[model samples]
Target: MTVRAANAEALRRLLAAEPVLTDCVSAVEAIGLEPGVVLHAGPPIGWQVMCAPVQGAIVGALRYEGWASSEADALELVARGGVRLEPCHHRGAVGPMAGIITRSMPVFVLENRAFGNRACATINEGLGRVLRFGANDETVLARLAWLRDEAGPLLGKALRRSGGIELRTLMAQALQMGDEMHQRNVAASSLFVRALLPSLVREGTGAALERLTDFLAGNDQFFLNLAMAAAKAATDSLLGIPGSTVVAAMARNGAEFGIRVAGCGARWFTAPVNTPEGFFFPGFGPTDANPDLGDSAIVETLGLGGMAMAASPGAARFVGAGGVAEALRITEEMREITLGEHPYFRIPAQGDRGAPVGIDVRRVVTTGITPLINTGIAGRKAGVGQVGAGVVRAPFGCFTAALEALAADDG
Candidate 1:
């Protein structure tokens, strides 16, 4: 077992799995996801190096896939390619920010149930102008068509009548109620609407249970893209693992900033996408942000956003830090480039320890210290949605090119 202790025991059995939100289909039935195939986020790009909030969410997913008919004919059919962009982590799926995913939207699946594996995302359209911050106007295509016609079949019939929804026990009770689940998912969106409020009142009513209870009581980052599709279904089960320097998927697409390593199977060790810094929003700043975009940093590859910013001092004062001892000194500089700790995402100010999970691209190129996300700045051009909230790092040339491609696969 010495391929780096079998890659730290395959990332300690992928941080001891347990994803579970079960279902809420339709990115063409949870992942068959056909039609025009748009899924965006980071790494597999095109449409002429897309960016302006992923070309305004690919012209709001080509007008939510009618194929066009405005947003300038969906940017002239995505500048004449006519959709088909790909890379919602090559489709197990994960979206947030301009992480677009189209074909009749409504996602949120999850699954990992100790690795049966499945992910998917899509539903949160709460923020202003929406369409994952790219804002495909018309009130973000009528709130993505009322989250695809009345809150995705009443939250997929209250997630099949609550047969599922353990998402790491609502991310360990939303990191003890302060939520470090990527830019604060306010107590995991109030414990996922109090476990879908008894099946959203026994399957909704009156404007579909008051527009799914005012879109989950006004989105406190609506459980951050279902906790980034349950951290991409629990780290896509530690990707390939060969000699795993673990760090599986930390996306972005407002330009670039990828990374996928558990033995580098799916490649993508990108760079460039930076521009975060912090605090802005009353008339915006940093020249109207947007650079680091979404896949909601796959919840810092499964530890908790910003590697559990010291158990989230209100997500380190909403990403600008200056409290809880600068969020426990940025979780002690992310426990020196992370390798382990998340036995259950603990972190009560670092004494209750545990939340730093395996990011180790050779300990981020021997501690150059990348990976400190906590984002949400978007709106550089697109329709001007989110314009501030900060901290962003991940990109020391994607951990020195995944440590020079794991030292050229060290035979």
Candidate 2:
């Protein structure tokens, strides 16, 4: 088949996806994650080559799982191969920075109702000193434990009682309400809390309900994981479309950036990752930033986060993408390389136009325009947590390599 035809079919499948938040469960329950098997963000890599933040997260997970008693012991365990590291994408899941998901961690489950495919992501731990950003102190561990033992189970019960929330509709509404669903998820998070509050109240007592409500209210990024899961489910539906050059996933492991093409099966095209160019936190600067990292780029693959930038002009200043004109220009430039616009995810700033969707590798190679990703920057050292938020471009080399492979297959 022709590249255009193949991409058309892939786009059709993507547009048909109907991702819904079906349930909440442990990583093991949701994705069959086994003991000693830890999933991290981006393409696979060994402990020796992993960046500081990822190594820090693995150490935290090891201690949290009781597989190791200390950071030194955790490093020893990883060095000896006592712990297995895999990419979340390898197991139908996605996660934010550091993106560590252990067996006991709670995951949000999203099912693509139209395609019968599913994907999951661990619950967001809020900002600052969180494990996702590589913080593993007692405070971080304690919060993680609370998520595993109390908040996770309660949220699961609430989801069960309320049936399931349809994510596409929620995301669409959020886009209209100035949320690009990454870097800035304030509107979606608020909407999600509003939807689940009644069910949570029905299932919890005074203090438990109060704690859960407070946590949800305080974490404006609470909906990010759910959006990641939804995007994963939606994009996975387009995989394996023979000859299609559409990008099915984009991820970073701090050390490397990678992309998977729909027609390329499971093969990954990778290159050295690029550090984000944007603002940093107080006392933090470019020198302290880690290279872009996370499975959160899956949202970009499905055309929500950075691709929908025009929808959230307020996020521009926060992520250092400049003013409204820059945001609009970014989205417009994105359209030059995408296959089409998302039918459901409309941008009100663009006169209710759908956000661009289906990142086409051929178009990217031809146009030399890589997809922009909205992201949180992790600190260079272990345990520093999030240093800032910004916009980064997926490595251009990944697209060129993917296009070459696709052309070879066609030849």
Error of 1 at 232 (Å): 2.6
* Runs off by more than 4 Å, candidate 1: 11-16, 22-50, 54-94, 97-130, 136-138, 141-201, 209-228, 231-233, 236-243, 260-269, 272-400, 404-411
Q: List the residue pairs that clash in candidate 1.
A: none
For model 2, residues 21-50, the per-residue Cα lDDT tens digits are 877899999989999999999998888899
Predicted model with the maximum TM-score: 2
For model 1, the run of ten residues with the poorest summed lDDT: 1-10
Model 2: lDDT equals 0.90
lDDT of 1 by residue, 92-195 (tens): 89888778888788887878877698888888877777777777867678778777887887898888898987878778868976789888888888888888
Candidate 1 lDDT for residue 399: 81
Residue 397 in candidate 1, Cα distance off native in Å: 7.0
Query: Which residue pairs in model 2 clash with each other?
Result: none
- List TM-score per model, in order: 0.34, 0.99
